[model samples]
Target: AQRVTQPEKLLSVFKGAPVELKCNYSYSGSPELFWYVQYSRQRLQLLLRHISRESIKGFTADLNKGETSFHLKKPFAQEEDSAMYYCAPPFYGGATNKLIFGTGTLLAVQP
Candidate 1:
């Protein structure tokens, strides 16, 4: 079975502080990993991808194959960064582009 797990439902932190959102997964085959974030009341957008090896919005994620984990990290948290973050894994082959999402972690960046 393919599944994604976000350990923390909420992560509260101060502005300029570091933030880390934990994510774990279970899949028999190779799967793509992505971090989708929603800032404040904004719609969910792609933050980063493990395959790209690039950072977006000051956030980066590393996919640990052995650990079956892909954790999102940012050195400095901005008040504007306060949002709901969801870690997801897309189904490789299907009729539609459907992505399985985690419960999500609400990041509160207090100023």
Candidate 2:
């Protein structure tokens, strides 16, 4: 079973429009969440963490324990923001801690 789930495979929005990427997680303990972003032909980079309570490049997410969700939101979408976003949380089940990432959501910012 996947520890994280990204409901939308692709979220399309026009320039200047708001965007939201939905994510849901299943875990027994309090899990810190991270959002990863991958731009065209670039390596995946850490976009933000829920614990920081800060926005990165106009994106922000709050960890909701009750709902087990960490939804990424941006007030305005830019064409440069088009990329793949992932919801990842560390998996402590094994001897080595690893990130368990969702399938990922593609954000398409259209002009």
Candidate 3:
């Protein structure tokens, strides 16, 4: 079973606070990991890729094969960064290239 699960439906926090977005996946074979973020009234964009090992908007994610998890974390939250975060696994071998996303985590930043 290839599935992506995001336990939290929503995550709200004050500005400047640390945020951790949990993600778990189940797959038989090796899968590619990605973090997609959509700001308020904005289109979805790629936040980071596990293979690249890079951080975007002060957010970073590490793929844990042992635990089958890819959690997104940020040291501090920003009001402007408030958006919907989705963890996705892209289809390999260029097979229509669909991204299997979790339900999604709505991050609210309070002033």
Candidate 4:
């Protein structure tokens, strides 16, 4: 079965501390992986995709094909970075495309 797993439901850390949110997936074929974040009272936005290899808000994620993992990381987390992060993958059904999200991890950055 194809599935995305976020092992952490909540992560709390002080400002400037390093943060890591683990994500793992199981799929037979190549699948597009992404991270989506939603801040307080804000809409969800795409944070990064495995193919992009770009950092957003000082956060980066590297896809490890050998481990089937895509863990999000930030060297120095900020209070403003507190948000709910989700691991997503594109799901194709018939002729339509949809996103399958794992259980989100809520990051709480304390001052």
Q: Which candidate has the highest lDDT of all?
A: 4
Question: What lDDT does candidate 2 reach at residue 18?
Answer: 95
The best candidate by TM-score is 4
Candidate 4, superposed: residue stretches over 4 Å from native: none
TM-score of 2: 0.93
- Cα lDDT of all candidates, in order? 0.91, 0.93, 0.91, 0.94
List runs of model 1 lying over 4 Å from the truth: none
Cα lDDT of model 4 by residue, 1-111, tens digit: 779999999999999999999999997788789999999999999999989899988999998889999999999999999999999988888998688899999999999
lDDT of 1 by residue, 9-109 (tens): 99999999999999999987776898998887678899888999998888999988899999999999999888999999888666765789999999999
Clashes of each: 0, 0, 0, 0
Superposed on all Cα atoms, model 2 deviates from the true structure by an RMSD in Å of: 1.4
Cα error of candidate 1 at position 54, Å: 0.8
Model 2: how far residue 72 lies from native, Å: 0.1
Which window of ten consecutive residues has the lowest lDDT sum in model 2? 89-98
C-alpha lDDT of candidate 3 relative to the true structure: 0.91
Clashes of 2: 0
Model 3: lDDT of residue 73: 96
Give the root-mean-square deviation of each candidate in angstroms: 1.2, 1.4, 1.3, 1.0
lDDT at 4, model 3: 97
Model 2, which residues run further than 4 Å from truth?
93-96
1-111, model 2: which lDDT tens digit per residue?
547999999999999999999999998888889999999999999999998899999999989899999999999999999999999997776687689999999999999
